[model samples]
Target chain A: MSEIINVSAIAKVEKEKIRKRIESFRSNGKATPTLATVLVGEDPGSVYYMDMQKKVLESLGGTMLKLTLTEDVSEQELLSTIGDLNNDDKVHGIMILFPLPKHIDEHKVAMKISPSKDIDGVNPMNIGLLASTSGGIAPCTPSSVVEILKDTLGELKGKHAVIIGRSNIVGKPLIQLLLREHMTVTVCHSRTRDLKEVARSGEVLISAMGRPKMITEEYVGDGAVVIDVGTSELDGKITGDCDLESVMKKASLVTKVPGGVGTLTTTILMRTLVDLYEKSES
Target chain B: MSEIINVSAIAKVEKEKIRKRIESFRSNGKATPTLATVLVGEDPGSVYYMDMQKKVLESLGGTMLKLTLTEDVSEQELLSTIGDLNNDDKVHGIMILFPLPKHIDEHKVAMKISPSKDIDGVNPMNIGLLASTSGGIAPCTPSSVVEILKDTLGELKGKHAVIIGRSNIVGKPLIQLLLREHMTVTVCHSRTRDLKEVARSGEVLISAMGRPKMITEEYVGDGAVVIDVGTSELDGKITGDCDLESVMKKASLVTKVPGGVGTLTTTILMRTLVDLYEKSES
Candidate 1:
């Protein structure tokens, strides 16, 4: 029987490290690292996510500054807010919540975030860092995948990894990280002609295509480690790209939709904030 | 018998397109795109490359601004020169001759070039664009790979591709591009275990690891399309990462060392210069 990889245990350990780091920073009177979460429009999902993240930061002894803007917030107004945050030394990290109003140019707003304070690591600087393999902050989702894989797989050197989806946030950056680890990594997306054949070849499979339950048993090789970064609401419940019920049966380790990567993502964000703070001071 | 992929033909077509585009831009009275080639030292290869590229641009009615600096040029001076070039509106692109002086921080210098003027597409902004998949100039070698793949494969959707090497210049960004094309892309490096198995599964195999003749017939499948992006001097002879004499027999299509991607790289740079000029004006 293949061993089950339970991330909750590892996540708890990492969380403690994050919490302790935050506590040390707080006790040192080095201002608590602060993240500014800018939300435009009222999406319940966005709100819930923001609140949960804020709480997570609070629990870790970090500060969360929530800036709420109306759905009709002009592009100029948003840009100004980001500019203001960029100048604020108190703000170590700034994240403009995704799914911005249609009228807003997301890329422009992203560009405004200071590369130094870009804890969410979605800014162009971080993206460049990933592309060049030089040191820079990493995008949260992909960084989390790297951390989890390292924890579960020990060393990724020479491992064959196949990624489903090529979204900027996950697949592309994840490929960069895997390359750094010296893993044989493959990225498959919508344009892919033979998905199953490609997936079956992986020692590691990462599903982040935003599709719900698309990966099945046929796509998995025996003893393959599966990480599902996809989050979709199916039947009023959150689900991942991999159909865990069947995949879990064939895989050595599989991350479930809800309790798997999603749980670790925000935690990683908090850790990134502390790291950024330390980096800034150094 | 598998048909040999003639990359030179594809490269010639692209070169012709660039030549035509430059001519068209010049005739339209558009700012004839100019690329300033900055050389820090007296490296023969660097000098040759710069002169060759300048000739290519000049033939197309574009201008080349040559800045030849002493080998002992200070970092501050180099940076200031880059700054000056950035402010020069007529200089649409800047190409820094590679292998700078030992004391210089190449990455910092590379980052200093304005993204709008980075015709070689080595700037952080372009690298960030590569990571984001939102579209930006890509490193010339990798971008050429993408261009060649599209011409040969029709559309790479769902193809299994493996890249050997993880250098910032090639492997990381190439993976991102391949992923963008909807191909299953894998990166394999020296630390990888079972490298042969990984290489054999790829419908497309790209060797960029700078190692000379590292990929042999044993490392490839029966009909894999091979792209060798490596340029190494072995015993005073230029060669690629693939053992072409043998691997060519196995590959359905193969790119030759000096005549393949390398020949197309400079033309792509010219294309990027024109592209930058167009983007800036638009």
Candidate 2:
């Protein structure tokens, strides 16, 4: 049986560290760090995700200023709201929930977020810094993956890491992070020819392709560390890319779906909020 | 026997296109596009590189504003120079020659360049744009590599491309570019295990690691398209990462060092100048 890694266990320890940091800020008479979250077109998933984040930030002594816009909100209106939050001294970090209405140019809105306040790391400047120098606020999902990998693998140098996916949010940034740790990374996407052969070669394999239960034991190597960043709804439950039971038979360790990368994402967001807050203060 | 690719043949064709574009700009009563090159400390290599670019731009009917600074120039002084160029209306693009000085922070200087005028694509915003959306002005070297690949292969989809080296300028950005072409990309570095084996897996192998003639025939897969982006000085001559004679025995195609990626780099620089100039005009 594979050692099933639960992110809640990791998040528990990280929560303690975040609490202490928040306490330090309070002791220093600094105002609580604030995250201004902009949501357009109330997608149920986005709504649930934001609600979960609100609870997480409150638990850690941070503030989430939720701004809700209708589905028909103008692009200029959304940008204006982002500008307001950007200028507001109370806002320490800013996050714009993904999947905005089709009419709104997502890239334009993303580019508008100040790098200093870009907690989710959607800003091009932050993304570029992550690529060019591996120094910047990385996207929360990718950052969570690195945190989990660090907690699990310790030293990532010289490892052949194969990632299944080429997403801007997860796979791409993760490649940069792993490369920074001196890992040789191979990114296999939909266009990859021999997916199984390439996937099996990784000492460390990460799947973020969002295809539910697509990766099986056949795709895994012996004693490989598997990280599933894929989240899909299958049979009304959150599912990951890996076939857990099948993958367990071959892998040494595999992260659980619902509580794996998803669980730590909130904790990492709070950590980023603290980081942006500190940067603003400095 | 392998076909050796020469960039001059490709550049000759591209130069005609540039010439006509310049003619169109002049016909419309637009002032010639100008590239402001900031050169600090008289490094022979950098000076030579800048002079070549100057000649290339002049050939394309563009202007080169050569800004020379002394060796002992302060960081603030260099940044101030970049700031002035950023605001200059006549300056369509700004390029800072490498190896500024041991004392100056290169990253800081790179960040100071405006993304709009960052012709070499060193600015974090541009880098982020490339990584995130594949919609930014990329670095000249990586852009040159893409030009060669596209010119040689025509369509890059689904091919396995293995790149050696993970420099900010070449490897990282090239991975993004190749990935944008829907090619499965793998990056190897000094820390990569079984470098030759990993390198041999690619149908298209690119060497940007500045180790002179490090890639041998054993590293090249049969009929693999090889692009040598590595340029190092060997016995007072420019050398590439490939053992050309040995690689030629197995590879279907190979690029020459001095006349390979280097020749097209100037054309691409002029191309980027035209792009930035056009953007500024619009």
Candidate 3:
């Protein structure tokens, strides 16, 4: 039987370490780091996610400032609110929660978030800096996956890493992280021909395609290390990209759906806030 | 014998098109486009390249403004000079010539260049936008290479494009451009293991590693399209990363040095300026 990896366990330990570091900042006479999240229109999923994020930050001894706006809020009003938080000395990080209303231009709003306070790494300036050099905050979910991989596998240098998806939030940013580790990286997407052959070729496989149970036994090789970043809703049930039952049997290591990358994202988001806060201060 | 692709021939035609377009803008009572180039030191190669850029812009109905600086200029002074050009209404595009003195922080200076005026696309915001979405100006060299390939190869939709460098200038941005065309792209750099195997695996091979004659016949496959972006100064002579004679024999098409992507870069810079100007005006 292959190794069933526990990413949440690793994240728990890392989260405590971040909390300890936050304490050091506090002891040094610095203000406690604050995260400001902007939510446009209260979707059930986004609200739930924001609440979970708030709880995670509180547990880590950080503050979560929720800025809830109506769906019909003008772009200028939204930008004005975000500008206020950016100038707030106590605010260290800002995240615009996903699924902003259709009327609001998401791209324009994302750009308005200050790079220093851009904890989610959605700003092009922050994202560009992350890819251009080793600078800037990495996107939360992918950063967590990479942190987990680093902890699980000591040296990723020269490993053949294959990613399924070319999303800015996940696959694209993850490619930059893996490349920084000197790994041979290949990104396969929907238009990619011979997906199965490409997936089987990698020693480290990452799937962020958001398709439920898309990666089957046919896509995995013997003893491949698989990281599933997919969260698709099917019949009101959440599942990952990889087929847990089959991937566990075929792969040497696997992260399960509900308890794997998903669980760590909140903690990772909080950790990123602390890191960005420290960086901005220094 | 394989086809010897004349990239300069294609570039010449495109340059004329841009010149004609500039004439139309002139007739419309608009001011001529101007390029502002910043030179920090008196390096011969940098001077030569800057002169080439100047002549290209002038030849294509544009103006070039050279701002020479002392080698010992402080970072603040350099940024101050850049800030002036950014606010200058006549300056449509700005390019900071490479190889600044060791004392200056290149990254900080690059960040200071305004994205709208950044013709070379050195700013991380532009690079990141190019990568993250289908928006923003692409770096000249890579954008030229993609345009040449698009002109030569009718549809790059399903082609396997491989790049042998991960530099922000050529390889990284080039990967984004190719990916936008729906090609299966793989990027390999100096740390890539089994370089020869990786080179032979792709149908479209690009070498931008800046190592003279690094890619020989053994690294190429039959009927592959080879684009060399390397320009290494060896024994006071310029040569590409590809062993051109050997690669030409193996590949179906090849872009030769001195007349390949390099020739199209200046024209593309002017084109990007016109594009940005139009975008800003609109």
Order of candidate numbers by DockQ, starting with the best: 2, 1, 3
What DockQ class does candidate 1 belong to? medium
lDDT of 1: 0.84
Q: Which candidate is the best by DockQ?
A: 2
Q: How well is candidate 1 docked (DockQ)?
A: 0.73
Better of 2 and 3 by DockQ: 2
Measured against the true two-chain complex, the DockQ scores of the candidates, in the order shown, are 0.73, 0.89, 0.70
Write one digit per residue (lDDT tens) for candidate 2, span B1-282.
Answer: 799997898889888899889889999999899999989989998999999999999988999999999999999999999999999999999999998789999999988999999998998888898888857888888888888889999999989999999998899889989999999999999999999899999999999989998899999999999999999999999999999999998899999888899889888889999999999999
lDDT of 3 by residue, B53-163 (tens): 889888888889999999999989999999999899888888999888998888988889889888888899998898787887788999888888888888988777879
lDDT for each of the candidates?
A: 0.84, 0.91, 0.87
DockQ of candidate 3 relative to the true structure:
0.70
Looking at candidate 3, what is the lDDT of residue A235?
85
Please report how far candidate 1 places residue B206 from its true position, in Å: 1.7
Q: What is the C-alpha lDDT profile of model 1 across A71-125, one tens digit per residue?
A: 9999999999999999998888998889899999888888888988887777787
